[model samples]
Target chain A: MDHRQEDQFEYQLKSALHRQEPPNGFTVRVLARLEPARPEPWPQPWLHLPSLRWALACALGIAVFAGGWMFQQERRRAEGEAARQQVMLALRITGAKMQLAEARVRHLSER
Target chain B: MKRTLLSVSIVVAAAICAPAQTIKVPESWDKLAAKADDVVNVSLDKKMLQFASKFMEEDENEKHLVSKLNGIYVHSLEFKNEGEFTESDVDPIRTQLQGPEWIHIVDVHNKTERENVVIYLKMVNNQSLGMAILVEEPKELTFVHLDGPISPGDLSDLSGSFGIPKNLHVSEKETSKPKAEIKK
Candidate 1:
């Protein structure tokens, strides 16, 4: 609140914020701390064999082809089954209507 | 000369590959369908019939019939109330069947009950080429068109092989409302 106290506060503030020499290897230590941790990659020695690479590729292709073929077969089967059901239903409905018509005709003939 | 030959071949191919007959439902029928509570519309082309034939293991007759069919179209609509559709709405299909190719087989109309059943057969050179059946009740309408060589005698086989369920009596069909299982 007084000039003396103000001067003392300014002096303390300057002392606390004044630049000072950093400890040895401060930059080196910070840089090392900032560096990210990385795990060693897994060994891929098989990847280097051309024949093995080709074989693996072929196996994948075969698997994909087989899966697609199986899916197509299943789709055809489902479609066939559905078509069969529709045919049967249509036939049944047609049959029922015809029967009714026949009975009516028979009744009329009797009359 | 090559172009002429190509055109001739194309025409021949079309004639050979085309179905015996086809049915066209009137556009107004679509309006009725919108008000229907349940509708059954099944259409199968030649390829589909062939595909279905493969699965008709239960019935040899079915397999034979399906293999010969070029197409089958069945449309049945059940309305929530009576008078959803009128006789005039069915006139277009009936008129179409009145052509020289189609012969009117059975026509039974009960004016009191407002029920009508009309059957037609498409004949080419005295051989039946197709069959069409139209059934109209107070609250329901059904039309079936089979495009292929199907004779009148075949009708009896159809009635017996896949006979109507015993519960689906003709008398009850007028009053009772039982949805066909396929409608589900």
Candidate 2:
């Protein structure tokens, strides 16, 4: 009984594990049964690409530097103009004082 | 590119139009004023001067003298005791201002009173461009630099509003005293 039962078990196992040719059109049938998988949207665009990331960072740096330089130049020009105007104004105020003084002297002479 | 270049050109043109000469005042004027017991520093640049003129009532007979002004910087530092600022401190300004661009119009020095008054006129092609007055006393140092075309008569017209008219109409008696004394 033990030898017969063991032989039967071995045969069943062999049969289960044995390689066999699939039926004709098996792949086609399986593929037809399978649903088409939906593609997920890209989480990150060009920034996720290692090559483009450095380019993006460099472009940003250049833009900020250029903006800062332009601003500095404009500020310098404005400051120079302001200083010049102030000088001229100082002279005018001086003129007014002198004129007032001369008028006083003239008025006295007339009296 | 064209627009940016155009804008830049406009800025350059503006810079050229008002080639502001460096108005000489002590760079330390603000600091000195801070150290004094009393300080009166009045700075009216071109824009401020223009804005101030708007408040003045329109006069058809007036020549709008204020429009001619570029700026007015007046700094008066009054100390508790004398010698808060040494003569060395002002000598640089005096020296720099002694060139042909300037003419010393009035020099009144009374050593007994320890007072000095000197007025400088900036002459360009026989026309006065501006004026600077440096007044020094034992306890006070006052400097006023007015830039632009200034006529005393034009100033007299605006005197009542500016507290300058009273100083302008000084009689012979007050004129005999130090003009600086009557100025305040």
Best model per lDDT: 1
Give the per-residue lDDT of model 1 (tens digit) for A62-81: 99999999999998887677
Model 2: fraction of the reference interface contacts it also forms = 0.08
* Backbone clash count for every predicted candidate, in the order shown: 0, 20
Report the lDDT tens digits of candidate 1 across residue range B26-79: 888778878887777667778778877998898787798889988888778888
CAPRI tier for the interface of model 1: acceptable
Q: After superposition, how far is residue B101 of candidate 2 from its true place, in Å?
A: 2.3
Model 2 accuracy (lDDT, Cα): 0.59
B-chain TM-scores per prediction: 0.75, 0.70
lDDT of 2 by residue, A1-111 (tens): 699999999999999999998999999888777646535556557668987888888999999999999999887666544444443333344444445445544544566
- Model 2 chain B scores worst on lDDT over the 10 consecutive residues at B1-10
lDDT of 1 at A90: 77
Fnat, model by model in order, equals 0.67, 0.08
lDDT of 2 by residue, B104-162 (tens): 65565656566666766666665667767787878877788778875444555655543
- Residue pairs with colliding backbones in model 1 are none
